[model samples]
Target: MRYRALLAFLAAIVAGLMVVSLLVGPAGVGPVAGIAALVDGKGALGLVMREIRLPRALLGAMVGGALGVSGAAMQGFLRNPLAEPGLIGISSSSALGAVIALQSGFAAVSVLALPGAALAGAVVAVALILMLAGPRGPSLTLILAGVAISALAGSFTSLVLNLSPNPFAVTEIVFWMLGSLSDRSMQHVAMAAPFMAVGALLLAPLGRGLDALTLGEDAAEAMGVRLTRLRLMLVLGTAALVGSAVAVAGAIGFVGLVVPHILRPFVGARPSRLLAASALGGAAMLLSADIAVRIIAPERDLKLGVLTAIIGAPFFLHLIWRTRGQIA
Candidate 1:
């Protein structure tokens, strides 16, 4: 009952935030009218509501949920609270791909090019990381490998941006790296949703294995939890989730990192419960952040990734300070 109640509360929050997201845009559509427009498809208001805000809200929820669940899975698998999707370098690689597409002028030619490139980059990065870490490797080894891959990807991305002849392309690269949901269309939803959904499905069933893993690797192995299979699922699932997110909205960081950590205590450190709670909590957080960016700077463009980093970095520093002994 407690667990259900918690989930219900989170769901209610996400639902309310979704409505708020729909109504909070620069279009000036009232909540009631937006709801009506979404349902009836009546006129200009309907067009704006359905075409613009609806996709944004839906994508926000989906992207947030993806990051949240992915983060939870990573933390559980690694037995580290600080584990996040970006730690594996998939997000940076995806951003690099998008930057290349922008610099090459391919993104201008086709709306799909940017996302396609991002997805490809994520796949390649994950493949290389897996190769470097090897199957059934130590978690520490994987983390170190991921750090190397991320640094390499970031360097390449910077090189591309610096070498671009078009100054406008450089600006686009900055925005893409920072992330946003503005001007997103149904096309992006179509491209990212399936991959994210697949990733979710793959990660969702691993809760039991993760919980058993809490008993340590030998115990988990004795209990029939295949570590190699678990690692495969975690890597592939995280790649899909992070890749699809970067493909659609660029790189919104800290979500997967923050949401699971916040919800872990409430879920009693159970990986299973934390998964769902983190998803809902993540959705709510992203929706709230998206709304705040619009309200705080109605005239200026504020990137979603920038806002999240601003909030997450301080929290992360505090976490590090609190765990200084562990690091030492």
Candidate 2:
């Protein structure tokens, strides 16, 4: 009952935020007219609501939900509360791929080049992680390998930016690395939606496996929770989710890391329940953050990633302080 109530509450918050998100843009559409325009699809108001704010709101929700769920799944699989989607290097690698595409001038040829390169980078990163950590390796091993991969990927991304001939391209790298949802179109929604949907399908059913794994690997295996399959699903699903998200919005941080941490206590720390909760919470947090960026700096182009980092980094320090004993 509590779980249901919590989920319902989060859902309500997300819904409210989505409505606000759609209505809060510079178009000056009221709640009633904005919603009406969404369905009516006739006038300039309709076009702005449907085309501009709608895609931004939808992508914000999707990206936030993906990051949140992926973070929960990662934490559950590793049995570490600190585990997040980026901990596996997938986000960095995807960013690297997008950076490369942007730098190489291929992105000019096709709209698909950026995201395609990002997805490819995610795949390669996953392959490398699996190779370095081994299929059956422990969580610490995976984390260490992921850190190395993330560092390497970050370096390559920096190199790409440094080597770009277009001075403007160097400036664009901040948007790619920090993430933003500005000027996003329905085409981006179309490109990323399928991958995000598929990844959600893969991750949603793993609650039982994560719960079992909480009892330890041997216990989980004895209980018939195929560790190999679970691991594969986690890697691939996270890759798909994070890859698609970074491809579309760049590398918005903290939603994945912070949302789960905030919602975990409410869900009794069950990975599966936490997944759903985090999804909603993440959506709310990001929508709120997006709204904040626009409100706080309507004139300056504030990066979504920058705002999240400001909020998350302090929280991260607090988290570390709380867990210092464990780390030591």
Candidate 3:
């Protein structure tokens, strides 16, 4: 009952935030004007609201929701609540791919190019991890592989920036890594929506498997879950969702790691319930962050990712401190 109510409240809040994102800009547009323009058409306020802020707001919700659900699924699959897209290097690889494409000057022709390369990079990282883990390797091996991939991708990104001729490329790369929803457009939405959709579809059904996984691989296998196939589905889905998010939005952290855990209690630790609840919570968190990013600057918009880091970093540190003993 609470879960359903909370979701409803979040939906209402998201709707309100969308309204605020549309109107609460430095341009002095109000919701009334924005909506009027949207409905009536042929107004400057309407166009800017429709073209700029609306797409960004929607993308923030979409990407944030995908990350949240993906994170929950990962944590379930790994039996580790701390697992996140970044920890496994998917985001880094995605960012590297985006950087390569952007630096190649394809981004100049179309912003969508980077996202494609990022997806490619994400798939590569997942493939490498799977190959390293093999069919029967332990979970720990897969984690180690992910860590190595992250380090490699990060170093390669730095090296690429250093080698790039365009001075602007370095700054751009840094900002992109920081994560931001600012200035995002329909092109980015187009690049990411299909992938994110696919990810959601993959993950929503894994709730039962997640429950089985909490009892360990052998236990899950005993419960009729095919361990290898389940793991493959999780890895591939997470890669597609997260890869596309990084491709479109860069590396927005904490949404995955934070949302599920925060809402775990509300849903009573059931992985399936947590999945849907966190999806809503994550959407709210990101959309709210987008609102914050726009209003806080109103003029000098910071990246949505930056704000999330500022907010998530402390939470993350506390989590690390809390879990250090456990991980060790």
TM-score for candidate 3, please give it.
Answer: 0.93
- What is the overall TM-score of model 2 with all chains considered together? 0.94
Model 1 ranges with Cα > 4 A deviation: 316-328
- Candidate 1 has its poorest 10 consecutive residues by lDDT at 318-327
lDDT per residue as tens, model 3, 154-266: 99998999899998887887887878887788888887888888888878788898898888888889999887777777788888889988888888988999988787767
lDDT, residue 33, candidate 3: 74
RMSD of each: 1.9, 1.9, 2.3
Candidate 2, residues 127-204: lDDT per residue as tens digits?
Answer: 999999888867778899999999999998878777778888887776667889888888889999999999999999
Which 10 successive residues of model 3 have the least lDDT summed? 22-31
Pairs that clash in candidate 1: none
Clashes of each: 0, 0, 0
Candidate 1 residue lDDT tens string, 1-328: 8889999999999999999888987778776777999999789988888888888998899889988999999999888888998899999999999998888888887778899999999999989988999987888888998899999999998898778888888888998888898888888899999999899988888999999989888899899999889988989999999899989989998999999988887888898889889989888888888888899897798999999889888987887787689668
* Model 3 global lDDT (CA atoms, 0 to 1): 0.82
Q: Rate the local accuracy (lDDT) of all candidates.
A: 0.89, 0.88, 0.82
